[model samples]
Target: MSKRSSISRLPDEVRQHIEQRIAEGQMTLDELIHDLRERFPEHADDLPSRSAVHRYGQKLDRRLAAIRASTEAAKIIREHAGDREDARSEALTAMIQSELFESIMELQEASDEEMPAEKRVGLLSKAAKNIATLTRSSVTLKKYQEEAAAKARAELLAEQEERLEELRGEDGMSEQLEDRIRNVLLGKA
Candidate 1:
Protein backbone atom coordinates (compact mmCIF):
# COMPACT_ATOMS: atom_id res chain seq x y z
CA MET A 1 0.00 0.00 0.00
CA SER A 2 2.99 2.26 0.52
CA LYS A 3 5.02 3.74 -2.35
CA ARG A 4 7.87 1.34 -1.41
CA SER A 5 5.63 -1.75 -1.69
CA SER A 6 4.89 -1.18 -5.40
CA ILE A 7 8.25 -2.27 -6.93
CA SER A 8 10.36 -5.47 -6.78
CA ARG A 9 12.53 -6.27 -3.74
CA LEU A 10 15.94 -4.68 -3.23
CA PRO A 11 19.26 -6.49 -3.02
CA ASP A 12 20.86 -7.38 0.36
CA GLU A 13 23.80 -5.07 -0.43
CA VAL A 14 21.58 -1.98 -0.62
CA ARG A 15 19.69 -2.97 2.50
CA GLN A 16 22.97 -3.38 4.37
CA HIS A 17 24.25 -0.07 3.07
CA ILE A 18 21.05 1.58 4.29
CA GLU A 19 21.58 0.03 7.70
CA GLN A 20 25.18 1.23 7.73
CA ARG A 21 24.10 4.79 7.01
CA ILE A 22 21.49 4.61 9.75
CA ALA A 23 24.05 3.25 12.21
CA GLU A 24 26.32 6.12 11.34
CA GLY A 25 23.49 8.44 12.48
CA GLN A 26 23.48 9.99 9.04
CA MET A 27 19.78 9.45 8.33
CA THR A 28 16.49 8.29 9.79
CA LEU A 29 14.99 4.93 8.72
CA ASP A 30 12.04 6.55 6.94
CA GLU A 31 14.34 8.90 5.08
CA LEU A 32 16.69 6.06 4.22
CA ILE A 33 13.94 3.85 2.77
CA HIS A 34 12.39 6.81 1.00
CA ASP A 35 15.72 7.73 -0.53
CA LEU A 36 16.32 4.13 -1.49
CA ARG A 37 12.99 4.02 -3.27
CA GLU A 38 13.87 7.16 -5.17
CA ARG A 39 17.41 6.02 -6.02
CA PHE A 40 16.43 2.51 -7.08
CA PRO A 41 12.78 2.62 -8.03
CA GLU A 42 12.97 -0.85 -9.62
CA HIS A 43 13.75 -2.42 -6.23
CA ALA A 44 11.29 -0.33 -4.23
CA ASP A 45 9.20 -3.28 -3.14
CA ASP A 46 12.30 -5.18 -1.99
CA LEU A 47 13.57 -2.29 0.11
CA PRO A 48 13.02 -2.73 3.84
CA SER A 49 9.99 -1.14 5.48
CA ARG A 50 10.48 1.78 7.86
CA SER A 51 9.65 -0.43 10.85
CA ALA A 52 12.20 -3.05 9.74
CA VAL A 53 14.84 -0.40 9.37
CA HIS A 54 13.92 0.96 12.82
CA ARG A 55 14.36 -2.52 14.34
CA TYR A 56 17.80 -2.75 12.75
CA GLY A 57 18.55 0.68 14.14
CA GLN A 58 17.64 -0.55 17.62
CA LYS A 59 20.19 -3.33 17.23
CA LEU A 60 22.80 -0.75 16.27
CA ASP A 61 21.86 1.34 19.30
CA ARG A 62 22.41 -1.65 21.59
CA ARG A 63 25.77 -2.38 19.90
CA LEU A 64 26.84 1.23 20.40
CA ALA A 65 25.90 1.04 24.08
CA ALA A 66 27.96 -2.13 24.49
CA ILE A 67 30.92 -0.48 22.78
CA ARG A 68 30.66 2.53 25.10
CA ALA A 69 30.56 0.28 28.18
CA SER A 70 33.61 -1.70 27.05
CA THR A 71 35.51 1.51 26.30
CA GLU A 72 34.79 2.73 29.83
CA ALA A 73 35.86 -0.64 31.23
CA ALA A 74 39.11 -0.41 29.25
CA LYS A 75 39.84 3.00 30.78
CA ILE A 76 39.28 1.58 34.26
CA ILE A 77 41.56 -1.35 33.45
CA ARG A 78 44.35 0.96 32.31
CA GLU A 79 44.00 3.16 35.39
CA HIS A 80 44.36 0.28 37.86
CA ALA A 81 45.94 -2.50 35.82
CA GLY A 82 49.01 -3.03 38.00
CA ASP A 83 47.24 -2.70 41.35
CA ARG A 84 44.46 -4.98 40.20
CA GLU A 85 46.85 -7.82 39.36
CA ASP A 86 48.61 -7.51 42.71
CA ALA A 87 45.31 -7.42 44.58
CA ARG A 88 44.17 -10.51 42.73
CA SER A 89 47.36 -12.38 43.54
CA GLU A 90 47.13 -11.40 47.20
CA ALA A 91 43.47 -12.30 47.44
CA LEU A 92 44.14 -15.70 45.87
CA THR A 93 47.03 -16.33 48.24
CA ALA A 94 44.92 -15.39 51.25
CA MET A 95 42.15 -17.61 50.07
CA ILE A 96 44.44 -20.57 49.42
CA GLN A 97 46.03 -20.55 52.93
CA SER A 98 45.43 -23.96 54.47
CA GLU A 99 44.95 -25.14 58.05
CA LEU A 100 47.96 -27.37 57.50
CA PHE A 101 50.25 -24.40 57.00
CA GLU A 102 48.94 -22.64 60.12
CA SER A 103 49.46 -25.77 62.22
CA ILE A 104 52.99 -26.08 60.89
CA MET A 105 53.84 -22.56 61.93
CA GLU A 106 52.36 -23.28 65.36
CA LEU A 107 54.43 -26.47 65.67
CA GLN A 108 57.65 -24.60 64.88
CA GLU A 109 56.80 -22.12 67.65
CA ALA A 110 55.97 -24.91 70.10
CA SER A 111 59.09 -26.96 69.37
CA ASP A 112 61.60 -24.20 70.10
CA GLU A 113 63.02 -25.93 73.24
CA GLU A 114 61.84 -29.33 74.55
CA MET A 115 60.63 -31.48 71.62
CA PRO A 116 62.87 -34.67 71.31
CA ALA A 117 65.29 -34.88 68.37
CA GLU A 118 63.51 -37.76 66.50
CA LYS A 119 60.00 -36.28 66.92
CA ARG A 120 61.33 -32.83 66.14
CA VAL A 121 62.90 -34.06 62.92
CA GLY A 122 59.67 -35.70 61.69
CA LEU A 123 57.49 -32.74 62.71
CA LEU A 124 59.97 -30.30 61.23
CA SER A 125 59.93 -32.07 57.84
CA LYS A 126 56.12 -32.03 57.68
CA ALA A 127 56.06 -28.48 58.95
CA ALA A 128 58.69 -27.51 56.46
CA LYS A 129 56.50 -28.59 53.54
CA ASN A 130 53.53 -26.68 54.87
CA ILE A 131 55.64 -23.66 55.76
CA ALA A 132 57.26 -23.75 52.35
CA THR A 133 53.85 -23.54 50.71
CA LEU A 134 52.95 -20.59 52.91
CA THR A 135 56.28 -18.92 52.44
CA ARG A 136 56.25 -19.38 48.69
CA SER A 137 52.73 -17.94 48.44
CA SER A 138 53.62 -15.08 50.73
CA VAL A 139 56.80 -14.35 48.85
CA THR A 140 54.97 -14.45 45.51
CA LEU A 141 52.34 -12.03 46.79
CA LYS A 142 55.02 -9.77 48.20
CA LYS A 143 56.96 -9.79 44.96
CA TYR A 144 53.86 -9.00 42.93
CA GLN A 145 53.01 -6.10 45.23
CA GLU A 146 56.60 -4.87 45.13
CA GLU A 147 56.83 -5.14 41.38
CA ALA A 148 53.52 -3.31 40.95
CA ALA A 149 54.63 -0.57 43.31
CA ALA A 150 57.96 -0.26 41.57
CA LYS A 151 56.28 -0.07 38.16
CA ALA A 152 53.90 2.64 39.38
CA ARG A 153 56.78 4.58 40.89
CA ALA A 154 58.84 4.21 37.73
CA GLU A 155 55.94 5.51 35.63
CA LEU A 156 55.40 8.41 38.01
CA LEU A 157 59.09 9.27 38.00
CA ALA A 158 59.22 9.04 34.23
CA GLU A 159 56.30 11.42 33.93
CA GLN A 160 57.89 13.80 36.39
CA GLU A 161 61.18 13.54 34.57
CA GLU A 162 59.46 14.32 31.30
CA ARG A 163 57.73 17.31 32.88
CA LEU A 164 61.06 18.48 34.32
CA GLU A 165 62.69 18.20 30.93
CA GLU A 166 59.82 20.13 29.40
CA LEU A 167 60.28 22.83 31.99
CA ARG A 168 63.98 22.97 31.34
CA GLY A 169 63.41 23.17 27.61
CA GLU A 170 60.78 25.85 28.05
CA ASP A 171 63.27 27.97 30.01
CA GLY A 172 66.12 27.29 27.55
CA MET A 173 68.56 26.07 30.19
CA SER A 174 71.83 24.75 28.75
CA GLU A 175 72.81 21.06 29.18
CA GLN A 176 75.38 21.78 31.93
CA LEU A 177 73.10 24.22 33.72
CA GLU A 178 70.21 21.70 33.62
CA ASP A 179 72.44 19.12 35.35
CA ARG A 180 73.50 21.69 37.97
CA ILE A 181 69.88 22.61 38.71
CA ARG A 182 68.84 18.94 38.66
CA ASN A 183 71.49 18.09 41.27
CA VAL A 184 70.13 20.78 43.57
CA LEU A 185 66.49 19.75 42.93
CA LEU A 186 66.85 16.46 44.85
CA GLY A 187 65.10 13.66 42.88
CA LYS A 188 61.59 14.86 42.10
CA ALA A 189 60.12 17.94 43.66
Candidate 2:
Protein backbone atom coordinates (compact mmCIF):
# COMPACT_ATOMS: atom_id res chain seq x y z
CA MET A 1 0.00 0.00 0.00
CA SER A 2 1.11 3.55 -0.66
CA LYS A 3 2.19 5.59 2.32
CA ARG A 4 -0.17 8.19 3.80
CA SER A 5 0.44 11.86 2.99
CA SER A 6 2.67 13.77 5.36
CA ILE A 7 -0.12 16.28 6.10
CA SER A 8 -2.44 13.43 7.03
CA ARG A 9 0.10 12.25 9.62
CA LEU A 10 0.32 15.68 11.29
CA PRO A 11 -0.91 16.12 14.86
CA ASP A 12 -4.58 16.82 15.42
CA GLU A 13 -4.06 20.39 16.56
CA VAL A 14 -1.88 21.19 13.55
CA ARG A 15 -4.43 19.65 11.16
CA GLN A 16 -7.19 21.65 12.80
CA HIS A 17 -5.08 24.79 12.40
CA ILE A 18 -4.60 24.02 8.74
CA GLU A 19 -8.31 23.41 8.25
CA GLN A 20 -9.14 26.61 10.10
CA ARG A 21 -6.72 28.64 8.01
CA ILE A 22 -8.22 27.16 4.86
CA ALA A 23 -11.73 27.96 6.01
CA GLU A 24 -10.81 31.52 6.91
CA GLY A 25 -9.97 32.11 3.21
CA GLN A 26 -7.05 34.32 4.09
CA MET A 27 -3.83 32.40 3.48
CA THR A 28 -1.96 31.02 0.47
CA LEU A 29 -0.47 27.53 0.74
CA ASP A 30 3.08 28.93 1.05
CA GLU A 31 2.00 31.27 3.81
CA LEU A 32 0.27 28.48 5.67
CA ILE A 33 3.30 26.23 5.32
CA HIS A 34 5.59 28.98 6.51
CA ASP A 35 3.34 29.65 9.46
CA LEU A 36 3.20 25.95 10.31
CA ARG A 37 6.99 25.60 10.14
CA GLU A 38 7.40 28.70 12.31
CA ARG A 39 4.90 27.50 14.92
CA PHE A 40 6.12 23.87 15.04
CA PRO A 41 9.84 24.32 14.51
CA GLU A 42 10.57 20.76 15.60
CA HIS A 43 8.36 19.50 12.75
CA ALA A 44 9.66 21.89 10.11
CA ASP A 45 11.44 19.05 8.31
CA ASP A 46 8.37 16.83 8.60
CA LEU A 47 5.92 19.28 7.05
CA PRO A 48 4.69 18.42 3.58
CA SER A 49 5.76 20.16 0.40
CA ARG A 50 3.72 23.03 -1.12
CA SER A 51 1.96 20.74 -3.59
CA ALA A 52 0.87 18.40 -0.84
CA VAL A 53 -0.38 21.30 1.24
CA HIS A 54 -2.26 22.65 -1.78
CA ARG A 55 -3.91 19.30 -2.41
CA TYR A 56 -4.95 18.99 1.20
CA GLY A 57 -6.22 22.56 1.25
CA GLN A 58 -8.21 21.99 -1.94
CA LYS A 59 -9.86 18.92 -0.48
CA LEU A 60 -10.72 20.78 2.71
CA ASP A 61 -12.15 23.69 0.67
CA ARG A 62 -14.41 21.34 -1.24
CA ARG A 63 -15.63 19.81 1.99
CA LEU A 64 -16.28 23.23 3.53
CA ALA A 65 -18.13 24.33 0.42
CA ALA A 66 -20.32 21.23 0.53
CA ILE A 67 -21.12 21.93 4.18
CA ARG A 68 -22.01 25.55 3.40
CA ALA A 69 -24.26 24.52 0.53
CA SER A 70 -26.01 21.89 2.63
CA THR A 71 -26.61 24.35 5.44
CA GLU A 72 -28.04 26.91 3.02
CA ALA A 73 -30.31 24.34 1.41
CA ALA A 74 -31.61 23.21 4.79
CA LYS A 75 -32.31 26.78 5.82
CA ILE A 76 -34.29 27.38 2.66
CA ILE A 77 -36.20 24.16 3.16
CA ARG A 78 -37.11 25.10 6.70
CA GLU A 79 -38.15 28.57 5.71
CA HIS A 80 -40.40 27.56 2.83
CA ALA A 81 -41.29 23.88 3.29
CA GLY A 82 -41.30 23.90 7.14
CA ASP A 83 -40.61 20.15 7.45
CA ARG A 84 -44.26 19.31 6.93
CA GLU A 85 -44.76 15.52 6.94
CA ASP A 86 -41.14 15.23 8.11
CA ALA A 87 -39.81 16.30 4.72
CA ARG A 88 -36.49 17.28 6.32
CA SER A 89 -35.98 13.78 7.64
CA GLU A 90 -36.90 12.37 4.24
CA ALA A 91 -34.41 14.68 2.55
CA LEU A 92 -31.67 13.62 4.96
CA THR A 93 -32.52 9.95 4.41
CA ALA A 94 -32.24 10.42 0.65
CA MET A 95 -28.87 12.16 1.07
CA ILE A 96 -27.61 9.30 3.21
CA GLN A 97 -28.83 6.76 0.65
CA SER A 98 -27.00 8.60 -2.11
CA GLU A 99 -23.80 8.70 -0.04
CA LEU A 100 -24.13 4.99 0.68
CA PHE A 101 -24.48 4.24 -3.02
CA GLU A 102 -21.39 6.31 -3.79
CA SER A 103 -19.43 4.56 -1.04
CA ILE A 104 -20.45 1.15 -2.39
CA MET A 105 -19.37 2.14 -5.87
CA GLU A 106 -16.02 3.36 -4.56
CA LEU A 107 -15.50 0.08 -2.75
CA GLN A 108 -16.33 -1.89 -5.87
CA GLU A 109 -13.81 0.02 -7.98
CA ALA A 110 -11.04 0.19 -5.38
CA SER A 111 -7.74 -1.49 -6.31
CA ASP A 112 -7.43 -4.79 -4.48
CA GLU A 113 -3.67 -4.33 -4.47
CA GLU A 114 -3.99 -1.01 -2.65
CA MET A 115 -6.30 -2.31 0.09
CA PRO A 116 -6.26 -5.43 2.24
CA ALA A 117 -8.94 -8.12 1.83
CA GLU A 118 -10.01 -7.94 5.45
CA LYS A 119 -10.44 -4.16 5.36
CA ARG A 120 -12.54 -4.37 2.19
CA VAL A 121 -14.78 -6.98 3.80
CA GLY A 122 -15.12 -4.85 6.91
CA LEU A 123 -16.16 -1.83 4.84
CA LEU A 124 -18.73 -3.86 2.92
CA SER A 125 -20.12 -5.26 6.13
CA LYS A 126 -20.47 -1.76 7.56
CA ALA A 127 -22.28 -0.62 4.45
CA ALA A 128 -24.70 -3.50 4.68
CA LYS A 129 -25.43 -2.64 8.31
CA ASN A 130 -26.07 0.99 7.35
CA ILE A 131 -28.54 -0.03 4.67
CA ALA A 132 -30.36 -2.37 7.04
CA THR A 133 -30.53 0.31 9.73
CA LEU A 134 -31.87 2.89 7.30
CA THR A 135 -34.56 0.53 6.01
CA ARG A 136 -35.68 -0.42 9.52
CA SER A 137 -35.86 3.24 10.57
CA SER A 138 -37.91 4.16 7.51
CA VAL A 139 -40.34 1.36 8.14
CA THR A 140 -40.67 2.38 11.77
CA LEU A 141 -41.34 5.97 10.78
CA LYS A 142 -44.07 4.96 8.33
CA LYS A 143 -45.69 2.76 10.94
CA TYR A 144 -45.62 5.56 13.48
CA GLN A 145 -47.19 7.96 10.98
CA GLU A 146 -49.96 5.46 10.23
CA GLU A 147 -50.63 4.98 13.94
CA ALA A 148 -50.80 8.74 14.45
CA ALA A 149 -53.32 9.15 11.63
CA ALA A 150 -55.44 6.32 13.02
CA LYS A 151 -55.46 7.94 16.45
CA ALA A 152 -56.54 11.27 14.96
CA ARG A 153 -59.32 9.59 13.03
CA ALA A 154 -60.51 7.82 16.17
CA GLU A 155 -60.58 11.14 18.08
CA LEU A 156 -62.58 12.78 15.30
CA LEU A 157 -65.08 9.93 15.35
CA ALA A 158 -65.50 10.24 19.10
CA GLU A 159 -66.13 13.97 18.78
CA GLN A 160 -68.71 13.32 16.08
CA GLU A 161 -70.42 10.72 18.27
CA GLU A 162 -70.63 13.20 21.13
CA ARG A 163 -72.19 15.80 18.81
CA LEU A 164 -74.68 13.22 17.61
CA GLU A 165 -75.68 12.41 21.19
CA GLU A 166 -76.33 16.12 21.83
CA LEU A 167 -78.54 16.30 18.75
CA ARG A 168 -80.41 13.17 19.70
CA GLY A 169 -81.15 14.51 23.18
CA GLU A 170 -82.16 18.07 22.18
CA ASP A 171 -83.61 17.68 18.66
CA GLY A 172 -84.72 14.10 19.03
CA MET A 173 -82.78 13.21 15.85
CA SER A 174 -83.59 9.87 14.29
CA GLU A 175 -81.26 6.87 14.66
CA GLN A 176 -81.28 6.49 10.82
CA LEU A 177 -79.94 10.04 10.40
CA GLU A 178 -77.05 9.39 12.82
CA ASP A 179 -76.22 6.15 10.97
CA ARG A 180 -76.18 7.99 7.64
CA ILE A 181 -73.81 10.64 8.99
CA ARG A 182 -71.46 7.99 10.33
CA ASN A 183 -71.47 6.12 7.03
CA VAL A 184 -70.79 9.28 5.08
CA LEU A 185 -67.89 10.33 7.31
CA LEU A 186 -66.41 6.83 7.11
CA GLY A 187 -66.61 6.95 3.30
CA LYS A 188 -68.94 3.99 3.24
CA ALA A 189 -71.76 5.98 1.61
lDDT of 1 at 71: 61
Q: Rate the local accuracy (lDDT) of all candidates.
A: 0.66, 0.81
Candidate 2's error at 179, in angstroms?
18
Candidate 2, residue 3: lDDT: 48
Q: lDDT score, residue 130, model 2?
A: 92
For residues 77-129, could you state the per-residue lDDT of candidate 2 as single tens digits?
88996644455566677778998998888777778786777898899999999
Error of 1 at 150 (Å): 16
Model 1 stretches astray by more than 4 angstroms: 1-12, 82-189
Per-model TM against the reference: 0.36, 0.70
**Which predicted model would earn the best TM-score?**
2
Error of 2 at 123 (Å): 1.6
